[model samples]
Target: MKKGILILAGIFAMTFVSCKEDAAKKVKEENVEMAEGRDAKNTDFPVMSFAKTEHDFGTINEGDVVEHKFEFTNTGKAPLVIVSAKGSCGCTVPQWPKDPIAPGAKGEMLVKFNSSGKPNQQTKQVTITANTETGKEIIKIKASVTPKAKPVSGTPVSK
Candidate 1:
């Protein structure tokens, strides 16, 4: 009777452990699915194809503000949704679409850079979070900021 009771208890413990592992695995799978979204398994997830990922503004004077429009297209079967866009620094601002772009539709990202205190060969990055498979993308802008030019007095310099 003692042997039978010990065997029964061991079997119950084994079953409970197996069930707990299975439950954990199920929860992990569900979490993955939730993080990836329902279309995660789809091969044709939204593709963010930028016409140009980087822009060169050449040389700009200090305190100058410049703008650029980055064109892009959704080349995937799924709709492209730009979740958020942020600049690398406060002086750089990015504007992106707030709506979902249909497949093959065109869109643009407007980025503005304020070179007030920025100097030299400055590279600004705009990180975009989107519904694409990779989930994030980056666009860059380069500019060389020159010092503010000193104004010349109208009066001629006396030698």
Candidate 2:
């Protein structure tokens, strides 16, 4: 029984070592690929130049829907392709252009924030994924919401 156990332990150790070596090799190859990609991006990348990074809606009542357009310019050598734009929350939605913008071209994205059920101060972020230098860009929206008062319900008072 002891001999059989030893053989099993040896096989397990060998498999574990082989897997570790394979993982290390894969990591090294991935690192090299990433480095090459970075070099390419450094040489030719799209730059996003926004007129404003943040917008303030001031004070709004609850259930108010507000929207704003953020303008940007592709001030780089390569065309700008926005992969995706995501909002931080469901209440905030962003719409961006699907077509790529040529260098030195202008574009705009519309962001809407629904103030339903959200009261007091609120801040939201929109993350844009693109082939830019940093690969990601962030824009923010802020607002101060005035909550609606709840109505009291009970017996009707005498007129």
Candidate 3:
């Protein structure tokens, strides 16, 4: 029975890998056509490069609002145009540039995470849609929220 189950899993894995390979090949062919009329020196697809893809705030107090700026550059020959950046939830918001980033130029995205009613380890992701080779990218924001310490009934306030 164990051997039969192992064979079934192997077959499933093979099928999944084959499907993934087919999708990758189709994307590659589309990219090749995307660069057809572009500059001779640049590929048809734009390349987006970021200084960092994840940021950790370590530990923050509850009700704190944290902000981070993600720096990125257009390393490809073509201009990088980001269509939209959407956050994972309402408490997490991302602001991206409306203008296109010319090749070799730099841009930034501002992401704010509010820990209003949230606690513990929180992670939020921002999905970016762009005209880059991969067409999409994701950035992560993480933080450990600690609630405010409460005072005992007999405790005296220190002034």
Candidate 4:
């Protein structure tokens, strides 16, 4: 009986030690993962770089739709994510890529400016918000438009 009791106690001690070691290992792994996540959140890198900071669309006629494309490159180590893009007014509309751009990849943003209600020399700006090393990237586009003169009607004369 005495021998059996000693063996059971020994087995229980061994099991407890093994469980404690496993718990410690799990905690260590969790700490490492948390550290990595925090680092990623704080990391910043440029996803794209524009050849020209701004685009200028020459003079355009009223009621005409003017379109332009702004090109850029992923100049960072990580993929580039564009959060959102917005135009200064309703006359200008912008379209951007929905997917993340990998490093060294190329991307573009297409912009269309409607001159239906716009007149005279005009300058517009398109703001792009991105997840990059710089936090946010802003790009501007400008244009000038001339509305066509109304046609003059002549009085009908009897021939």
TM-score for every candidate vs. truth? 0.70, 0.77, 0.67, 0.66
- Each model's C-alpha lDDT? 0.93, 0.95, 0.90, 0.83
Model 4 misses residue 127 by how many Å? 0.7
lDDT of 4: 0.83
lDDT of 2 by residue, 1-159 (tens): 999999999999998877555455556777789999878767678899999999999999999999999999999999999999999999999999999999999999999999999999999999999999899999999999999998678957779
Give the lowest summed-lDDT range of ten residues in model 2.
19-28
Question: Residue by residue across 18-122, what tens digits does model 3's lDDT show?
Answer: 755455655676667777746465556778789999999889999999999999999988888999999999999999999999999999999999998888999
Q: Which is the leading candidate under lDDT?
A: 2
Q: Given candidate 3, what's the lDDT at residue 63? A: 94
Q: How close is candidate 3 to the true structure, as a TM-score?
A: 0.67
Clashes of 3: 1
Q: In model 1, which runs have C-alpha deviations exceeding 4 angstroms? A: 1-41, 149-159
Candidate with top TM-score is 2
Error of 1 at 79 (Å): 0.7
